[model samples]
Target chain A: MSLHTEYSGPHAQARSGPQVAAPPPRNSRHAAPGAARRFLSWLDLKAAPYLLVSPYFLLFAIFGLFPLGFTLWYSLFDYELTGEQEWVGLGNYSELLADDQFWKVVVNTLAMFVIATVPQLLLALMLANALNKRFRGQLFVRMGVLLPLVTSVVAVAVVFTHLYGRDWGMVNWLLGLFGIDPIDWKAERLPAWLAVSTMVDWRWTGYNAIIFLAGMQTIPRDLYEAAEIDGASKRRQFWQITIPMLRPTIIFVVLNSTIGGLTLFAEPMMFYGGRIQGGSDNQFQTVAMFIVEKAFSNFQYGYASAAAWLLFLMILIGSAINFMLIRRIGGRK
Target chain B: MTTLTVRRDTPGARRKRTHRGGAGSRIWDATPLTKVMLAFTIIVSAFPIYWMIVIASRTNSDAVDIPPPLLPGGNLGENIVRVLNDPDAQFLTGLTNSAIVAVSVTVSVVIISTMAGFAFSRLRFRGSRVLLLAVLLTMMVPIQQMGVVPLYRLMVELEWTGQLKAVILPYLLNAFGVFLMTQYTEQAVPGELVEAARVDGASTLRIWWNIVLPAVRPGMAVLGINTFMITWNDFMWPLIVLAGNPTVQVAIRNLNAQHSTDYVMIFTGTTLSVLPLIVVFLVFGRQIIGGLMEGAVKA
Candidate 1:
């Protein structure tokens, strides 16, 4: 496209050295055409795509790939605040592997994953199906469903914390209406997980629902019509038609939520605070929180990096397993 | 909407609506009622938000009532005053920080991704295929997981530990934006037109400016809003990076910590944080979904 143009604007093409505009084709033919003309066109074709892709590569190498290598390097050495260092090599990983707290964190993560993710996916699917049908006030309802994903986790955590509070909390107040007493939510493990998971399900269930809704919307109206002709009821139609058709999106949300769930932080950290360092006593201290405590509270950067790597390995392996599960589900005949 | 408004107005529209809504439709679908199910879902889903507003408008004493004030009260001003007086009251500062960072990151991302996307999808260049794949792979890497340790250390070393740039710089060129822009550019842009512009004596930049950008402006709008929201709502990265300075999200964290004793103030502060996002939704909600679906289905 740089055949000819005025360079007067901000988005204008940058100049390549002292070259003036390439001479017009007529002038070029009259002047010194053959080899140079052939070369320019080839260069132009080659250069365009190169110019297109360089930005991502340049940025990724510096920011993406380099940081990963640095993380590995940091994992090997005993980095500290007191300016002392020693070669740890595999020592950090060994320590993490043997630690009961590390395993507890893993179990905590998986438990929360099962609790929060399963319900989130199920409710999202149900809501999306319900929403796909025509209705009164549909726009308002759709927008309402999405309100939570738009809010920050910190905001969500605070709002839910208020709800989960021991005294005067809306949750406890509601339970009192059922003749139940106020519970000290943050003091216990199960209550804390329930508190954090409630926040997760509230915020994300709708986000996933929107994705499912989008998937449902595109299932081709004829698919449902065909299902109806086969004498399928609405319930049967949902499982047979909607669930099957929404498979890819179901997988997308699963993988996306798995990543988010495994790296869970903020919501739980704020929920448990000092309880996190208590290890076994803390039921909800996921691996990410465990790493955060190692780095921030204990000031063991090398140990923290090891913990982080171990967690990363778990995510990679879990993600691979999830890939298999999704494939099996998606590939179902 | 037209159906909704015109239906009841027609004496006959109610009968025609038999194929769809109303109590009888549920019977046709079966006694396993749909509206009842939907209403239940809405109540369970919407109660927390309703409860937030209810809690935010009452005093600590009133907030702790046996049957809490389900109705809105006149204590919003007092709640705000208490929330403001609290030592962790960085919400106003955080609001501005969020605006600055989200806007800057969105602008940079939009401009760069659009240019890169245009180049990949329309203007053919060497390794464009390989590079697009690389960009896609980048999207799958879950950067927050990978960047944690290095990013924290880098922030510390650069003396950006408590600065807005700590959050802003790392997020500028997100992979999702690149992927989104690629989809938009491919559809909105065409090769023949780009070639024709070049043939008509426009420079590469001129082709992008005069031809490509106008075609992709709708996309730019979507990408801009999505990127803004992503940056604005980011939690873990900013939590680790900035120590003293608080973005709106980080400020909400600080507020939660300091106002641990006062649920009403925390509720009020959270409500304040949500207000900007609500504005974001009102303005760009329709286009944001379209953008997200486009990226997802295409990928």
Candidate 2:
């Protein structure tokens, strides 16, 4: 703990500042001279901050940074759990491009991404607006909105699967009461997409609403008051004031929802009975689920790595486009 | 910032055209139609969870009935006991494993993020700004599936592939946690306090421990609960890492896989697994929501 013995380096305790080194205690007058020399090196200002902050960076290098680099490296090899990895050098990428299943999964992912994220953001905005009002039981309503988000994805999926069941499911039953024919939610493409998107919307709408609400709170109340004074309808004020002011928050919600939608795995996986292939027809298998299937189920690490890289690229591009879209929309104002 | 006032000031009147309430009044006041819409939305939001509990309370015969029970049945105790006693599910073990992982990860993240966030926010260290930027940049990069392949390999190399520590260790270095603490510390703890502590011959560690930690309790509470919820809900990573030793989510998956048709048992297991979180949310929902909203505002 002492600098005198631990760090005998030249610049260890040779600080020019008055408070750099604490003087020896006056009560320890009879104490040995060496005791005064032995300052607590743990208190060394130059080294202490680094020591305090090192854990996060160190862990990041191992778990985060290294894994990012290694994913790219691993994609080039024909790797397996037990077998020796061969130097494939873009072979995996070529195979992924040619794989029809991969393209099908990509199409499915994009469709589901749009289905889930679009309505989710729209609904979230509306819900945020509604909750931002001066209503009785506001806390109760807010908590109710967040209920889906609090529940585990596994639980949500399980419950939804029951609700979307062919015969006894509540959804079909409800449809029946409205004079509509019962549709098989899982087997059919459109029904399946709707069912899954419903799950996504149910879980996330409130969360995004909270974020939107936060953004809305920051907008000065005077803006709304002024708009009201001008005889603007509530709808007009919403379109003109609320939406424009919430641009940054909307962008955040959009980008995050894109990322979340693209990587959706659990809800679909559990809905389709815990299989990587989302359904018998593979109508809802996301790219993320496909990657897991390739790596774990099929034992094709190289192929999985390639798919993973593709997903990452897609997200990067998606985020860039989202950012530009928001910027353009903001500029139009 | 002005405190929000209830625009409707009429105590006894149900309907009033309050001209003095300002321009935002039309939007703020709830119409009969708005009430119906909001009520419907709230129902849609909370109905599934209510439905889950209903299913859990029903017997298998009651559960699979043509008109599935909309109300809670009398078989709650029986189903819970059956789910707990199921040979394949291992509900208790999975709960234990999840708790271990969640608690460990939460504790570690709070401590590490606090220290790192404090340093970045308060300490004047060399390359601090660059390091902080690096931390922020990591938040944007999605943890893709390929990264897991390499991460799994790293765990294998360290001979920690199947352990809870493997799951706990990587999550401890959350970029969001670091960013959350950094923002919280900047606003909550004054720079002059840190400077005062430094001038008093107190170590940086002491300042963080005795001063910064106590000051950021609310932030830490939010961070801790969020981390716990995430860790508890984590499925894919735990499934991959703890391959043989499945956590609660994986166990629930396996439960459904083996039983295949036992809806009552599956719902029971799901309910049991979800109960602890429901409890946590009920207790700390306000703090968690407030913290998240506050963080969003700062961002």
Candidate 3:
């Protein structure tokens, strides 16, 4: 990382503003002229680095920093749709603090983060360990797992919505084969969460598996070799070696999943019927859904901005906790 | 626990207990067991997608049969036609919208990131370190967390509520693409090459067009497909931006609104929308995986 970072420093130095390189040290036989040429090249090189690196900064400032800085400014003001506005001075945040819907959305978002993320990570780990073994048609299998991840989430949500139906649905049909009754999956709270989480699980588990598999492949064959020589069982090897070695990968998936899970939107929104009110009576409505609904449906730009910030703060803290947790796990390994 | 023995111990000892390691011949070893376990692994991994395709192919009636149809059926074409022709189904339009968004985003990402990368990796200018650091720092910020409110406001103010460009334009400078190009540019392009071009009195713009671009095209190919797949599959920003416009995914969202009565219609739409992405992956998946691996190994 340091080497790449340092290398870019030199890269920037070389491309600064367009000074044509001084004509190759002509009459270099003259010591004084040669010295002056060397000085000129050094100055040109110094200026070159700046010109090269300028675009990234300029663009980042415009696209990245400016929008973010403006978000902070907007959060403090009570601005409405169609030019209605006033300075709120933390009034929005105060209202959100007392808002029960906000808390419900927060809790619902957390419930999803726990309900979906942990099991998803575990499944991905198991799948990775399975793929780490040699197999015929390994390429086909690996590519096949990626199908769900590569496909649009909307399509997956649509497929699962079919599967989750109480009647005329494949999942219910399968359950009926075992003499089980069909389930009204999206019409209730818990079932809705399960339905939404299942969609997430199907789409993401393979992606995390591939990430884990990539990490596992980098573990030398000798580690497994050494464990076998010690008479350790394969399960023992997995627990002792694979799990510890995969700790960082686990952390990576967890962090990615945390960010993804908290912002749960389209899947649940789609599952619950994406009207102004989502879920089975807003049971599955997430903070993101709330923000979008508030912003567009009601045109409460001030209120929506507040909700967006509240969610943003929740995500920021959630992301911070995720980072802290990952670093701690990584430290253990 | 038994699965553990499969990975560690040999395949035999079923008929008679050859308990220990050296009790068996060395060559007879773990081959059969490895092959069996490997087959199980692959089957389990590939089964769900196979199930989806099979389910997608079945008629609405056969699809919900008590046993659930494991075999592919002949109704896929019928379902596809129904999906396209349905009054409420904007699937074809959505597909077109997806293509437009994905292509535009990919082209812009590749062009901008490449140019910025070349500039960062090849030039000398003032505040280069600070600017480069700023770009790198944004990588740490999840684009969704802090930027959503402001970005939404900006789009709304720009009167881009139902525009594809609303989604396509804002997230153009992908943190990963910019970072990737910068790294690739550093290696593939040497400093002396640019200097040589400069000393020859070639303009900086001319050097960029002729010399630097050729040096870093392979990187662009990897980044291009990645950007396309990413923007194409993205759910959130598009879901927000395309609220009224309705992308393929949004159409799917609307399908869910009609209840399970339209199961066949919905699956048909799902199949059509996901098929192109699967094709894209089949074509470029290896390169995408390779690029990710390259970055991982570097990190």
Candidate 4:
């Protein structure tokens, strides 16, 4: 708005003019210091705002903008850590498109995204509904649900990895009680996906629930009261009113989960005991792991850069799809 | 506001009101089933952490025992000692490094965000609106994933690959922190207060120091806590860059890799890594929860 220059420019001049004109004979001795003070204050008014905000911008330009641009540049070249640098010009992208392992990873990533997100969001919505009720120890309940979020992701992965251990693990042990054979969580595709999905959901569901609860709190109480007066049951009102009113929050949560879910790295990586391959068969390898594996393990810097860009595109597509889907939820009366 | 009054009403009065043709309004009062379901959710939320502790406290064979030890064992102290003394794990260094990095990043991010937030909210300047929008756009780009290759190259060129600075510098500027604080400052510090301070001849920095920061202290606390937690738990970047000298997360990965079958030792290290955060969560649980929900709505 340039409000700073407009206000400070003429205003400072006007104030200083009056001060100079009205200065007493005795005060004339202090005129120099007064003018210096005015100049310093003027500088503070004119420049402090920029100074205050520069750190984030400066740091972002260096660390954020540069790398983003550099990644694009790196993706265009056939650059490796130790090998000769050559121009690939989207060759990496084409190779990635045809690579069977790459497509498998993409499927694995999306499958895990759905496997993790569908139940996680639904559970969060229900949990939010439950927490929205007026209850004793509400704060206690919120803290308890959000406790998982406090633990490190690796720690969560490590614990779950042990629990899902094929032999003598708690999960398989529980399954044995159900007359089902012990599942190899790491060996098979479906079981591995399920294992990683549980880890994701366990860590994030409560956090999302809290966000949903916040959104629920903002919906007017009168809406519910009016629905109730119209003889609508609680369940009916929830379906008709709560779900529709929570559309924005649903979109927010859905987009966040999409980006987060597609970037599934630490959990699956730790699930396979820190192997970037995800498993021996690559059953649960994510695009993120693939990027890391290509760049660091194989030193294919340029190829990894292309894969990273594709991952970004995947997130964009994922978010757009989820956004449209969420928009459809309760949008049609 | 009406809801606040309704919530404050005596339970007996509320029950009486609900009884008199307000059966549907009883929705707000959780049924016993909801309570049971909520209890189960809490258990599900907390059990992994509890299980981690149990395994940490048990012997190696007891950890992978048939039923899997559900209760804490007497080996906790011994295991902790072993983990601390283990050369390969470097449990103590990881903790210290994580603490240093988390604190450094948290303090820097909070201060930077507050400064930027105050400016964006209070100080009217050229392009402020556009700059704020740019910050929002940056939040959508996952720079950590997108920038890994170049950032790694930069770190290697600068000889910062193994140092904590490489991990610290990139995360110092958090777009989310700036955005959160901007929203919070707008709501918390009134425009009239800034005008009044300006009329009183307070310098812009003074107004920020005397008025904005004090008003936004809660926002700062929220941001600080969240940043601390995220930084403490950050894995991918640290795993990539700080390979030999690692944070708690990468260290846990290393421990898992080294002792893939030594369940108790690995569990012990995991428990130790998460213990500090658990203590922080327990102490500041209320503020963290309140701040998070508040930030969620405002954001």
Candidate 5:
């Protein structure tokens, strides 16, 4: 039965039985050795690939996929971290939808996403375009721009939080040069969003630009040369040729920014001094922060799971919407 | 399309255009304006980090002084000592734990990624296509956020909370790393080379070690650096799981919360946390840049 199954296996041709073919009479004494060799080789061929790939699948199954499925299961029950679980089908989701604070967090998350991503991407695009031009110290400039990325997000938030200090921040000090009053960066909603967005953009803009620069490098030079020959201005060429050719890269970047922006947590959390409240009024509390607050702070494990699902859905909807919008860029003549 | 066809018609024309370096090169040439813009960009990119250092080195009074000091001060050593000795922050422990987690995660992710990459790219096996697609799908979902609840509960059940194991286990296998390595291996290792190695009766593992690993070292380096940077800077998960025992990011949070008024000490801790990565960046900046661009295009 084992032999039959082996014969019918996927690599049967390669692993065909040595016994099926009449062994040459001259080498009949070596049949056992030959079969052993074939078996070893068969095992090598059949097992090595799975062995090579098994670590990833095994680890991901335990850490990634299992938790993903369990999150959905957890969301269906009224679960708490204090070891209580009651089945309440969609109860958490329904309560979350009507929860005023939850909606505010969703709004804050989306507001910050748009506030951060739109200008961040636009600035990165322009930075990439500028960097695409041949320069003498190209590598130096690139490294300098990417320097912020090396700093931890918490570190960036710490520095920016101080810089946005209501009384004596350098930013407010700079504003005071123009006689403008001090702005309470954490107290107000819009200012808080701007402050957090700045932190996000400060860290990521250069990284995105480098990716965009990479994409720009892959576009054939002839297309630009042709557009130049046709008397199209540089600005027009960028809009017409560069944007169209960079569609795949744009899609990749936009989707990445969508997921990242919606998941804004550490910057705002640290901005408000490491409290998950985001502010006393919950002014800058992102959905991610809200989820953490619910699960860890309030011990609403099931409700936070539902919020996690909603954040996932928000990412999907945001990516799809942005993908559609990006596809239209340079689509028309 | 017309230009593409024209380039195909005269394949060397683009190369010739670049050599001519007249009007055609103008498009690629950096203008004075471009140089100025890039300079401003570099400064803006670097200033916050510079500001961190300036404040870290200054006195507490200098930290909030009107028109905040923009230059380094002599108090840096004193403040760093204060941070290291701070009982509440546990800054040194945070730094050491972060280093351990980052190195372990980077090494594991790179090795696992390279193996899976070689298998998916060089080996012909059933379910390869479907499995690779699954890895790609895995990359799309933010598993950390989605799985936080159950993962936390699992950790709690296992009694691993506040341990480095809780912080490090989830990150040991990264889908992005696998996807990157697979793309890289496909590009870097030729099919003919693998076939030739096989013809020499090289076992799959031998071929991987001798042929695939050597060829894909650059890809591994890229993945390793990126993974290290990410693991070092990872905030939310570590903050959630290891809140008591804390990584560097969480330690900074502790310092910020506990000593909100101790600007110099806080900045000192922040600077110390970032200093090692800056050193790594300085050493491997070129490879990091090249590998990132290369990975971007391939992926």
Candidate 6:
């Protein structure tokens, strides 16, 4: 990384600006006599680099940064759609702190994250191990795993909503074959959480498995051979070699999963039969869903902005912990 | 513990020992347990999609049957036609709207992200490091849900509330896209190539057009497909901005709401919505999988 940085310095200097390139040596063989050519050459050298990079910063400022800062500003007032704005001065945050619904939504989000991410990552590792082995039809199996990832989250929710149907759903029917009663997946809180997490897990496990598989491939094959010669079983090699070598990848997956899982919106919304609210009783409503509900449905812009800030703070804190965990793991070795 | 020291044990002989056994060893090495586990994974992976097909292929009555037609039924064509002709959902118009928005945003995202990525990777400028760090830091912030209120207000204030541009404009600049392109350009277009071009009096734009762009073609292709898919499948932002003018996802959601009791139409609409991506994935599975895993590993 440092080498690349140092390498780019001189290259950047060589073509830093068109003004420098416009002045030719007194007896240069190639010289542009026309003002147009010099101007074009100058634009190419000095202006193009900045022009190339300006779109992102420009759009990001207008759409990304402005809206975020506006949210912070909007949180300070009791603004609602089609209503007169009034200065509240941290009133929304105070109300949000005391609101039971806000706490419930936060807990619901955390529950879904824990429920979805734990098994998802574990199964991803196991699947990656299975995939890393050379075999017939390897490409076919690999593609099969990624099928869910490529499929849209809304589509997955649509299909799983059907599967989790009370009476005629495939899952319940399979359970019936084993003499278990049908489950009203969406009506009950635990069942709804499970159903939503199942959708999350199904979509992500394969994607993460591919990542883990990539990490596993980076492990030298000779290590497995050495372990084999020492009479270590495949399981032992996985425990002793694969897991430790995969620390960074594991950290990456966990942090990503934490973020993705916490901002749970689409699945819960769709799972609740296309309603924005999680259920009839708000059993499975996540913080994101609540924010949307408050902003659009209830038209409480200030309150929703406060909730959004809370969500951002949770993400910031969670990410910091994950970052520190990565550092600790890195420091240990 | 000795395994950690093994890298030094045979530094020069590493190449000789890489392929530990012959092809015969691979054929006889698999155990029953591993095979069963792999089979289970394959089934789990493919079954939901297969189930979607089955549900979409069946009629309303057949779909609600106790066994629920394990295999796809014979009503696929009829169901698809019904779904397209359904007046309430506007599937045909939604398809056109989705195509326009997705393609427009994808083209712009590819051009902008590639240009910015090339500049970041190859060009030296003041505050380049800080700018790169800013881009990466933005990735950690999930702003979609949080920013909806202000974004909605902005669109309304600009009289863009019901316009597709309301959805298209905000998403053209993606942090991941820039990061991916930068990483790819670094490896794909070597510094020596840029240095050589500079020595030959090639301007920055000239080098970018003649050298860097051609070198990163594969990366551009992957980024294009990824962007198109993300734009096409985007729901919440489009849901808020587009309002009554529906994209494909909004159309599918509308179908579900209007035909709440009719599983056939809902399933059919979803199947139609997912068909293009499925086809794209099938055709370019290798490149898509390779690109995604490459990005993940690099991250």
**Candidate 6 chain B lowest-lDDT run of ten:** B1-10
- Greater DockQ among 5 and 6 belongs to 5
> Which candidate would rank higher by lDDT, 2 or 4?
4
Q: Rate the local accuracy (lDDT) of all candidates.
A: 0.72, 0.81, 0.69, 0.87, 0.87, 0.83
Using lDDT, rank the candidates from best to worst.
4, 5, 6, 2, 1, 3
Tens-place lDDT per residue, model 2, B45-95, is 788888788888887777778766789988889998998888787788898
Can you give the lDDT of residue A156 in candidate 2?
91
RMSD of each: 7.8, 7.2, 8.5, 5.8, 6.4, 5.3
Model 4 stretches astray by more than 4 angstroms: A1-40, B1-25
Residue runs of model 6 more than 4 Å from their true location after superposition: A1-44, A325-333, B1-30
Tens digits of lDDT, candidate 5, A1-333? 132333243234324434423333444555567777668767998999999999999998999889889888888989656678899999999999999999999999999888998899889999999999888988899999899899999999999999999999999999999999999989889999999999999999999999998878767788888888899998999888888888767888888898889988999999989899999999999999999999988888889999999999998888889989987874764
Report the lDDT tens digits of candidate 1 across residue range A1-333. Answer: 232232223123323223334443534534555677656656765675566556666767767877777767777888667868788898888888899988888888888888888888989888777776666776677677787777777777776776787876788988988999889887776777778888899998887888887767656565666766777888887777677777777777887887888888878876743234523476788888888778767878778878877777777787788878877766663
Tens digits of per-residue lDDT, candidate 4, B1-299, equal 23223332233343454344455556588889899989999999989999899889988889868877778988999999998898998888899999999999999999999999999988888889899989988888889988899999999999998899999999997999998888778767767667645655667988889878888999999999999999999999999999789898888899989989998999999999999999999999999998898777666
lDDT of 6 by residue, A152-255 (tens): 87888999998899989989999999999999998877898999999999999998999998777667676777777788887888878888888767887888
Candidate 5 vs 6: which has more lDDT: 5
- DockQ each: 0.27, 0.38, 0.27, 0.47, 0.47, 0.44
TM-score of each: 0.86, 0.90, 0.80, 0.91, 0.92, 0.90
The pairs that clash in candidate 5 are none
Q: Write the per-residue lDDT of candidate 6 for residues B1-299, one digit (tens) a residue.
A: 13223322232353464466785345225466767887888799888888888889988998888987888889899999999999999998888889999999999988888999999888887777888888888887787877889999999989998788998999886887888888778767777768756655677977888888888887888889889988898888887788788999888888877888799888888888888889999999999888776665555
C-alpha RMSD (angstroms) for model 5:
6.4
List the TM values for chain B, per candidate.
Answer: 0.84, 0.88, 0.83, 0.91, 0.93, 0.89
Model 2, range A1-333, lDDT digits (tens) per residue? 132233233223333335544543542464556553345534467888899889999998988888888888888999766878999999999999999999988988888888888888888888888778777887777788787888899999998998898888888888899998888899977888888888888898999999999778766666878887898888888888888877877887888787788888899999898877899978889899898888888778888888999999898898899889877766665
Error of 4 at B46 (Å): 1.7
TM-score of 4: 0.91
Q: Lowest-lDDT window of 10 residues in candidate 3 chain A?
A: A1-10
What residue pairs clash in candidate 2, if any at all? none
Candidate with the larger TM-score of 2 and 6? 6
lDDT of 3 by residue, A1-333 (tens): 233343454356545645644443433445566567567656655654455444545656756777677666766777666667788878878887898877877877888777888798887887777776645676677776666777777776666776776766777877888999888886777777777888898788777878887767656555777777788888887777777776656665676687688777878766655564656467778888887777667766667667766666776688788778766755653
